[model samples]
Target chain A: MVASFGPVALAVAIATVFGLLPLFLSGIIVPKKPDSVKNATYECGVETIGPTYIQFRTPYYLYALLFVIFDVEAVFLFPWAVAYRQLGLFALAEVAIFIGLLLVGYAYAWRKKAFEWT
Target chain B: MSFLSCPFPALVCNPFGLARDGIYGLLAAIVPEPLPTVALTVLGIAMLIAIIALTVMSQVWVERRAVAFLQERLGPNRVGPAGVLQSVADVLKLLLKEDLIPFKADRATFVVAPLVVLVPSLSVWSLIPWGPGLAIADVNVGILLVLAIGSFTTLGILAAGWASANKYSLLGGMRVAAQLISYEVPLVVSALVPVLWAGTASLQGIIESQATVWNVFVLPVGPIAFLVFLIAGIAEVNRSPFDLPEAESEIVAGFHTEYSGMRFALFFLAEYSNSLAIGALAAVLFLGGWQGPILPPYVWLFFKAYAVFLILVWIRGTLPRLRYDQLMHFGWKVALPISLVTLGATAVLVSAVQGTAA
Candidate 1:
């Protein structure tokens, strides 16, 4: 039964090698002849312009922040769900309260248009 | 042969189990103390990798042929009798191409990014229950483990995009992160339907609970949960029209734009493998993993998975990609609220039924 850990550990270890194998093999098998022109940042053969990193719009960050709230809500719900059968009606009442609190936050977000992409 | 004694539905008439036990007993005796376990582990892991690698190769071929057929093209029929060897040929070609590193790119991170993306995608396949006693491991937290490992793909995409130092790659990476995180809400919430109904998170246990009726047919919210899981699963894996992260026309291959040779191939393989993994998870969770009256359990599982994949391909062939804003809107506004309500309703209904019965 200890062998059960075998696939899991082996997978973790093998994942690195799996990722690295092609890179390593390509390093050995493939021919590399690099020049400045070939290695330049690809911009349709035009001269590279400003810095590659640009400031993204604020909407992305807003979306991510909202996602974090829902994600945590999901995590909290999991334990409640797994033990829901044993928890009885008291548990249902607690969940109703929990969801109400989360809904308050959700309603606020909706009213504020945080869900809007623009 | 003692290991064969484990009570499992499949083992009752399983020829594979009988044959596998003979090898297990022989393997157990052939090695010295403490070494046998390690040897078997190596053998098991190696076989798993081999199976997955072969599946990935064939999957690439199937996608090409299926998509081509959908588009009324003949597709690759020259290589190895009906293009069966096309993926193998493609692999050779990929291996021989120059490994390109973009100017000003972060070398170490760029080199490692594809691996990071691919490793998690492959590792997620380990916990899938192909049949009774046929999974790699049935960890109690198997479903949670899958959801957690799945999120790692987004991180890997972010790393690839940032390390490339390309504007397109950065956009792709950010989009992947946003999209994946948003979709994870629905995925996890819908998945909880199965977990809650089955009263266990173990993949096999969920399937066992569905022995009489699969979750998709089991009442008020089962179909709703399955549909939510399906949509979220598709978005989770970055398929069209949800594939804004790597939208080809807009971003020129997105986060992987700067990658060439095997590195790009790794990302490609990871994408398809992730698709397959999500399909298989859907099969296990809703359609009843490896459960059927005719054929074998694993066969049923594969049939359902490939059916899911075919639907993905059909969607790809028919639908136009959504805009970035539209993608985010769908995830946040549409998917999130519906999943939350469904979860609440399911909880209430389940409690009502169970409360009365008790």
Candidate 2:
């Protein structure tokens, strides 16, 4: 396991250095010029209207949550597929049950209007 | 035939005997056995680093040229032959640019998000058996590991978008989270077709089974699964036609909008490298990975990988971005059901065949 992770650790370290070091060097090398307009949020060429930060609708969160549950469940299907031939009918039956459960969940969500585009 | 004059001279000279004698001499002199495992580990790390670096650089140029060709314009031709060095030049420019951090952004999470995206993308390569006995790990759960690591990328994208503290960034993050999670199901389900056919989660075993007849030919459903996998994989990586999160026209570069210089570059690296990862996985799972005549295994592996990468480039150049609602609907309504049904049918067929065979 240690040997296997050696490359990953090195790659991460290199990526971190590549990402952070240049930024640090630039801050020291470049001149800083500050102004109110420079720091203001860019909204095309038009004058700023309303606050830049505002609370978004909750539906987006619901969509994302639903996505996660389904996405992960989907991932579980790959391994089952790989072992499909070996699992034979038994594995197929098991997956059917799994999909059935997921469909039920989907139906409940649909009934609750989780997917409604509000 | 006279052994001395024949090509069997090496055998006649007792090469093994001589080598054994030499080893005995070395043992007498207190020499230890060379650590082949350590050497192999070091070599694997070096090779992986090189692969990641090259994949990122080459993909940048490929994407630019592909997009340019599609738009009927010339892309970067001055720096090197056929603008091959354009990506290198971009790297230099990024290196010189100012690194900016938004004042309101969460610094730690903001800094870590890129790493989170990049590291998993790179690590997935470990489980990918490039050729027989060529991979870093031939673990039985290799396929599972790849899926797990692939999904972690959604978290990274969300983190980058949320921590940036910009409205666009937050929106981008939410979009990415939804997109990635939604497409992941179809991707995994499609990948399962091969595993089910091969009956092993080990990548090497899958490829070995394809030696006689490629999986693409074995089942009529294989190509469909490959297609689904490719589409979903592209969406997972947030590429064109599914790049709602980073819709530059709308989100101003999306999740990494607030990032600059190297921080932004990390995200770029992650995105391109992840593309290569998915491309490679697709080639191995669907195409006959490293199973061609004449050429060595590693060479065939690289060819398949590059070919898949080119396909991605072609799609990016040819296809327009899907509307965000369309993207979501396609994933949930279309891909999910298709994959689920495909998986169900595949299961039934495999069992029926096994029952007959047994």
In candidate 2, stretches whose alpha carbon ends up further than 4 angstroms from where it belongs are A1-53, A75-87, A111-113, A116-118, B1-39, B356-358
lDDT of candidate model 1 versus the reference: 0.82
**Candidate 1 per-residue lDDT over residues B1-358, each given as its tens digit:** 2322234454553545665667678877877656655555555555666677788898888888888998999888889999999999999999999999977899999988888898888888778877777776678768888898888989889999999888888989988988898899889999998888877888888888888788888787889889889999999989987989889898888899888899989998888888888889999889988888656667778788878887888888888999887877787788777887787777777776665223
Cα RMSD (angstroms) for every candidate in the order listed: 3.0, 6.4
Which candidate number would show the highest lDDT if scored against the true structure?
1
lDDT of 2 by residue, B152-244 (tens): 888989998888877788889988987887787788888887787777877877787677677777676777788898999999888887889
Worst 10 residues of 2 chain B by lDDT: B1-10
In candidate 2, residue B337 scores what lDDT? 82
Residue pairs of candidate 2 with colliding backbone atoms? A81-B196, A82-B195, A82-B196, A84-B196
Which residue pairs show collisions in model 1? none
TM-score of every model? 0.93, 0.84
